[model samples]
Target: MRVSVDTDRCCSSGQCVAAVPEVFDQDEDEGLVLLLDAEPPVQRQASVRLAAGICPGRAITIHEE
Candidate 1:
């Protein structure tokens, strides 16, 4: 799975970060979504999906490769 984040669409709600801190983060100054891992381990797929779903801004995109 590949994870991509559109920072421009991020609302900085931090839902993604809260859901999956290992995969996502927020810039302190801009409050934009920061993708820590574009390709996370298989074990982290669920959390990544959850984070993507919970993102109010729909900034997170997951692609299964």
Candidate 2:
């Protein structure tokens, strides 16, 4: 699984980080979504998909392999 985030579209809601802190984070300076793991471990795939789906700004994208 692959994950990416669009900071330009982020609303800084931190939903992604809350859903999957292992794969996402928030910038302290800007509070924008940060991709901690572009390619997270298999165990984290489910939460990653959840994060992408719940992102209020639609800033998260997932590529399944």
What tens digits encode model 1's per-residue C-alpha lDDT throughout 1-65? 99998988999999998888999999999899999999999999999999999899999999999
Q: Could you give candidate 2's per-residue lDDT for residues 18-60 as a string of tens digits?
A: 9989889999999999898999998999889889999989999
Worst 10 residues of 1 by lDDT: 16-25
TM-scores of all candidate predictions against the true structure: 0.96, 0.95
Q: Best candidate per TM-score, number?
A: 1
Candidate 1 TM-score, true structure as reference: 0.96
What is residue 39's positional error in candidate 2, in angstroms? Answer: 0.6
Residue runs of model 1 more than 4 Å from their true location after superposition: none
